[model samples]
Target: MKFTLFSLCRRYPIWVAVLLLYAVASLVSPAMLNPDQVLNIVRVTAFLGMVATGQTIVLLTGGIDLSVAGVVTLVNILSTGLMLGDNGNIFVAMLACVAVAAIVGVTNGVLVAYFRIAPIIATLAMNSILFGVALVYTGGAPHGAAAPAFNTIAQGDILGFPASGVCWLVLSIAVAMLMRKTVFGRWIYAVGANARAAAMMGVPVRLVVVAAYTLSSMLAMCGGLLVTAYIGNPSLGIGNSFMMTSVVAVVVGGTALSGGVGGVVTTIAGALFITELNSFTNIAQASTGAQFVIQGVLIAASVVVYRLLARRPRA
Candidate 1:
């Protein structure tokens, strides 16, 4: 019984951390327990959650997508610019955003999978290129407004629940199912676990890697669109925060940095934890610097905890 408990804890440490965090937060700010406040936290978490879902997939394939931050910003600018607050333009704007995102994803994938470029360097370079493009297009000042219908995606609620939250939950379930139930999902895990071995087993390693990167970029774009809608305006550097938070959420959710060990479901908990942490800090009037420090410490601590748990022998 003890061993079973330990194993369960080892496998799902993120859930444990989340419970502890909520308990402590409730103690510090009892108002945090309110249903309205809790729902608000879920609503805000949807954006980060979407980005981190893609990050989780990339990480599972033993890669990183630093370009996700850039994808977010670019999509925000492109979507709103094309939409120009006109509802009729929404379809065209969104289609353009997805096309650009797919191109970016495919490029990153080709660089890393086909050309053997390091994932970090390749994605980082793509990020820089994207930022440059955004800068050139926006002329240092992005201008546009999200249409009322577009804004409803993030700003409206359904049956007293946040629409964004509902969307995220539905999407996450679909992704989780895809990863668990499909042959492609198995290929992803196989490749992440051992690329050479996967290739030997006829796993089409290159294709899997490319698909992972493509999905990452596409999801990052989705997240960016949601953020654009919520704010109803395009803003430069709007996605800068996701660069750190997405990876942090993935790591804290018990996903192995070395890859092949985590999934989108746990990332959901991780996103919630991160959003709650930020909300609590804001309520406590913590400085931006302090918040960074807290997040940094949390990441380090989670890494160590997971490593220790993973290293422990099963009884």
Candidate 2:
């Protein structure tokens, strides 16, 4: 039992640390331990955590999806703009948003998988297109309120915990289990490790790549719903910062940018660490600019440290 728990700890130090921090915060300030406060933090983390999980999966398969923020923003608008007044419109609107996200994902995959375009450049261009499409759809101003049911996922708790938090936790566990205990999971790591080698070994690298992007799109759409509700309305550029934040969380959670080295559990920790930092900063009355400066420095320093630590001395 001890060894089992030790292994789990080693495999999920980031999450362990986050939980530890939560415990400490609660002890230090009892208010932080209150159900409402704790639930609020978990609820807020869901959108970021859900989006970051998709990013983690894509990165694990040796790719990045820069269009996530734009996809999310666009979907938020779709949900609000189309479904705000009619309950009957919600389902169709959601399908349309998801369909759009899938099309974008497929486009990204096609460019990177077959055209041999760099994933970064391909996704970046896609991001531009998605942003433009969103701008055109909204005409420079976004209007629409998220439906109450949609908001409930982020706000309503079951016996004390937000439903979105539960959703995130369950989804993370499922994804982690899928990655660690399934054949597709193995294929993902293999592709991330070496696409050419994976092909040589009979892995369907191209299909895997495309499928990863599709999954990413799905996750982004889910996050968009949560974000729209979390903020209470659709606004222009509300999801603008998510792309960077998702990448930062993935990296800070100990996932290798080059791929195949981390899990969703760690990304959750990275999200909490960031959210906690933000909360602490707000508590300290720090400016938004100051927060960004500190966060940027931390990200840069972390990358350097990762590079140094990940290096091997010349043999």
Candidate 3:
């Protein structure tokens, strides 16, 4: 069992780093050393983890989605407005939200895949468009309440577990399976590693890229909806932090910014680490601006270290 655990650690070195960080944070923040803090960490991690999963997919194809915050904000506005605290309307409202989210994803995909625009530029522009659309739809201040039933999806417990945490676990496991056990996963890796080569080998490179972007946006939508439910109302920039934090989580998880080297496990671990760090910040009474600075530093440090490790001479 010891050897087996050791082998698993060797297979996933980032997990070891995450554990170390967790231990250090726990030691520093006595509050976080308790069992309840574990659940708290999982609950918060769920929201970021969902977004990170989508970002992971896009990054795996050597692409990035800067529009996630927009998608989340838009979805949050639409879902709450449509539900209007009516449980009877939740199904329809959620369906509408998901549809709109998918359309946004498709737009991002088409721009990047068909128009040949840079992913970063395309998604950034889309982010502006989405925010504008949301503002127009809300007439500036969004006003509506999430259905009580809908709130249960994120706010309530499921079999003694936070529903959001359960959702996170399920999504993490499913995405991990998809990445490791599917043909589409192979295509993702291939295209990220080399689009031209993948296309030469008859892979539907454009389709894959589009699918990845679409999936990324939809996942962001899921996070948005859950956040809306959790928060019980509407806000314009609720998801703004997600835009950068998702990227940070993906990078901190050991994924290559250049693509082709990340998975669901890595991303979930990253999300957990980020959430844990944030909790520590709160406990330590760090300024909000300091939190952003810390995250930015983490991203830069991750990239530098990853690039350096990649450059190392192989045995």
Candidate 4:
């Protein structure tokens, strides 16, 4: 196969964006170049990275999971409430959280894959349901705190790197490999590229779709756990930011909103770029509305740029 600049950019726009953003950020705020500050960005990116990883998978399968935000909040509230600051409760809390997340994921999968509901509407409705359950469970006032031991996952370091970052790195590598080297991974892409064709080819389209959604929810739960660990307390709307940000990361990473393109690897850079952008905005004292506007522009720009690059003929 021949290579071209447009192809290269199409394959790795987010990586380019990350480098450019870092260069600009360092020039604008020298503190951004600090080792500690860089680590802090990595640390914070882990939470969104974890969630966006799943988003990447779902997008690959031609689906969206708006419910991720709800999953995150529900998991956060449930895990902390169940843990109640006790180490012994951590296991039970986690198990419960996993179960709940799985149920939610399965429901989303069934609705989209079997019942033929549109992904956006299905996941959006699911999000509402999940948030409602969380509200009812907490009565608008969540209780409990993260156990000290559990907090180590997000707050502690491994070999001078944030533990959560390390975890994100390991999981990303594992997931990337799965998507690239496994039959199931192939099925996901096949289904996304054309579900009718994939089904005709005996790809088990519904199963793949269901599995993708399940994995998405599970990873969202993992993200929720990490965030809960960092905050150490439950709060309503704790995951509100992730709803759009997760999609932003995935889209900016060059994943096709239409599906069957992009992978988790680029999303790592996408996550880093987003965190760096947020950090830079904070350092520059930009208003919250400004940040949102910037993000919206970024998303639109990325979509247009990627589409253009994708349309360019190979050299």
- TM-score of candidate 3 against the unseen true structure: 0.94
Expressed as tens digits, the lDDT of each residue in 223-258 for candidate 2 is: 888888777687768778889998998887888889
TM-score of 1: 0.97
Per-residue alpha-carbon lDDT of candidate 4 for residues 201-263, written as tens digits (9 for 90 to 100) = 999999899999999999899899999999999988898989889999999998998999889
**Total clashes in model 2, counting residue pairs 3 or more apart in sequence or in different chains:** 0
CA lDDT of every candidate: 0.91, 0.81, 0.87, 0.92
In Å, residue 312's CA in model 4 sits off its true spot by 2.1
Q: Tens digit of lDDT per residue, candidate 1, span 1-315?
A: 465756667767888788888889899999899999998998899999999999999999999999999999999999989999999999999999999999999999999999999999999999999999999999998888889999999999999999989988898878889899999999988888999999999999999999999999998998998888889898878989998899999999988878889888999999999999999998878999999999999999998998898788755
How well does each candidate superpose onto the true structure, as a TM-score? 0.97, 0.89, 0.94, 0.96
Per residue, candidate 3 scores C-alpha lDDT tens digits across 46-88 of 8889999999999999999999999889988998899899999
Superior candidate under lDDT, 1 versus 4: 4
Model 2 TM:
0.89
Cα lDDT, model 3, residue 285: 87
Model 1 Cα shift for residue 286 (angstroms) = 1.7
Residue 118, model 2, lDDT: 88
Clashing pairs in 3: none
